[model samples]
Target: MDRSLILGLLIFLTLLAMPFALPLIGQGYLTGLIIKAMLLAIAAISLDLLIGHGGLVSLGHAAFVALGAYAAAIALQSGIENILVLLLITLALTGFVALITGSLALRTTGVYFLMITLAFGQMAYFTLTSLAAYGGDDGLTLWSLATLFGSNVVQKGNGLYFIVLGTLLASWWFVNRMSQSRFGRVLRAARDNPERTEVMGYSVTRYRLVAYVIAAMIAGVSGLLVMQHAEFVSPALAAWQRSGDLIVVVVLGGLATRNGAILGAFFLVIVEELLGSFIHEWRLIYGPLLVFMVLFAKGGLSDLLTSKRRGNQVA
Candidate 1:
């Protein structure tokens, strides 16, 4: 087996152990934090599939996340109880929206693509705010969460944590597998030279659209999990700021690298939590920290971990 696969396996093992280990140390609350990070990682990994490999920088990815949450929340609010059914609803809504918006967004590239996605995302945000029945700007509180075949396991506690961790791991593996496939190679080719790829008879737009839909669907799943974990969601979940944060996580984790977004999510969340505990204006410190990392750490947090190993190999 490849060394990277071995490394990934070890990391998953550590994550699996944390739920059991953290409580013994009286830091069970950290499990929730881990769940949060994992949720973020799920979304980030999807975004990475777009920006890192497909070279499509979007500013509306979070719209899918919100759509997922809203779809599931509204379904449950209307008496839908089964987690499986809710997931199907969330995927359908998000996928449909992604298909429409991606078709329009794909008409542009580079900064224009970024702007168009932001526009679509804002459209989603405004639409969410208009749903007064769902609490509008105040957000909707899910009075009852989804259940797994009459089991509340996925709705709270360690069950929720493991579910999220499993999802994150699955996402990591899925995206990684896709990135190594022939389709991934073509996507990267389109990213590097579209005209050349078109000359080769590949439909660049089609490839990108598929990638967009895949990413959006993954993000939508993340949103559903987020809603279950928090039990509340607002239109703010679809905002451009949330999209920006996803971008930050992907970039800070290391574009096109396995485990980068996961590491970035954990790092960002832990830093935010630690800083917020000491000061109310942690954002005052946060911006510069990101700036420093972008300027100094070319490959983000993932590189910091493997740089030594790479160096020894080169030597």
Candidate 2:
């Protein structure tokens, strides 16, 4: 097998072993932290599919996440409590929204595209805040936890952790497969040279729109998992700041690297947890930290770590 496959397997094994080793480490706190990291990792991975692979920088990705969360929450409230049903509803709603918004957003490019996406995301947030039936800005709580195959699967911490791990693994595999597929090649080609791709008879906008919708759908799955884990949904999920944070997580992990998203999520969440313990104003630190990251580590945390290995191999 190739080095990337071996590396991916190693990461999967580590995630699988985490829950088993948590109690022995006297650090059950780490388990919850890992779970949250995995959740964000899923989101980052989906965003990476667009930003890193498709060369589509979206600032409104969080809107789909919020849409998924609200879809699941509202469905559960309306007596649709099965996890599968909730997931289906969330995916469909998020995809629909993406389809509509992506068509319009794709009309612009570069900075204009970024601003349009940001605007749409803000609109979604405000719309959620207006839903007084769901507690508006206060958010809405799930009357009951989601049922998986008629069982309360999420009630078990290990069960929930494993489920998320499984999803992450699946997502990673799916992305890798897509990256190697014909469609993925075309998308990457477009990213490299859109004018040439257009001249080659490919509708660049159409391809990008599809990629945007797919990314949103994947993000929707992450949203479903978030609601299931927290048993709550709110406008906070859709906030523009949340979208910014997601972008940060993706970039900090590394652009164009599959594992970077997961690594970035883990790193950022751990840093937040550690810093927040010592300083109540942790974001004060986070702000500058992000600046330094973007300014210095252009390739991301993973790239910095692997640079020596790459150089050695080249030498």
Candidate 3:
């Protein structure tokens, strides 16, 4: 089997077993931690589609996450409790925002595009903070967890955890298929050399716009899961720092690999949990570690792990 495939399977199995296995080791309480990692992974995966494939680095992608969370939370407050309805509404809002922002952001390249996206993200963050009806700067807490067909299915046991796991798996599969499709090919080609791709008759901007919107919608899904899990919505979810962390996940995991997001999220969460458990000044160590990891781990953990496997196979 391909080394990457083997690694992917191992990661999937570990996540699938976490809800059961953690209890055996007395770490069952970490179920929520793992679920949170998976939820964040969804956002990382969505961001990867842009940074890794389309060569777009968005500093405001977390805005979509906040948008999705707030959209669902607001709906629930208005007496909408169905998860399906909430998800649909979340995606629509995220997509609309992505479309509007992406259309304008795509007109610029490199730093300008990055800045424009960042500006849009700040706009979103402030907009949410100004909505006094929704708790404004203080944030809004959901009255209850999201429901499925009028039942608290998602709130029961590992239901939401498994739901997030399944969604992550499905998203990974979808992104894999997309990365192999003709559209993926064009997007990648454009990323590597826009001039040549345009000469080949592909509209680089159009492909990028589509990818951006897709990514934003996926991030929206992550937001919904986050809101469901935390039972709260705040402007902090859309903060620039959250967006920075999403980028860190992508870069920390390895760019362009389907497994990067999953691996990175797990690694990040574990490191933070471990360090924060002991050190009050954890970021002092964590910050330097990230810089070193990016400096030495060229393709991040995913590529490093897969390459080691391939090397062992060759041996």
* lDDT scores in order: 0.90, 0.85, 0.89
* lDDT for residue 278 in candidate 2, whole number 0-100: 97
Question: In the order shown, what is each candidate's alpha-carbon RMSD?
Answer: 3.2, 3.2, 3.5
Pairs of residues at least 3 apart in sequence or in different chains that clash in candidate 2:
none
User: How would you encode candidate 2's per-residue C-alpha lDDT over 1-315 as one tens digit per residue?
Assistant: 655456668888998988888788888768888888998989889898888778778899998988998888888888997888888898899999999999999998878888999999999999999999998999998768788878887645898888889888888888878877887878888888889999999998899888898889989998988888887899999988888888899888877675778889989998999999999999999889999987887778667655432210100
**Residue-wise C-alpha lDDT for candidate 3, range 157-187, written one tens digit per residue:** 6998899998899888888789879999998
Native-vs-model 1 lDDT?
0.90
Indicate the TM-score of model 3: 0.96
Sort by lDDT, best first: what order? 1, 3, 2
Segments of candidate 1 deviating more than 4 angstroms: 1-3, 308-315
> What's the distance in Å from true for residue 272, model 2?
0.5
Count clashes in each candidate, considering only residues at least 3 apart in sequence or on different chains.
0, 0, 0
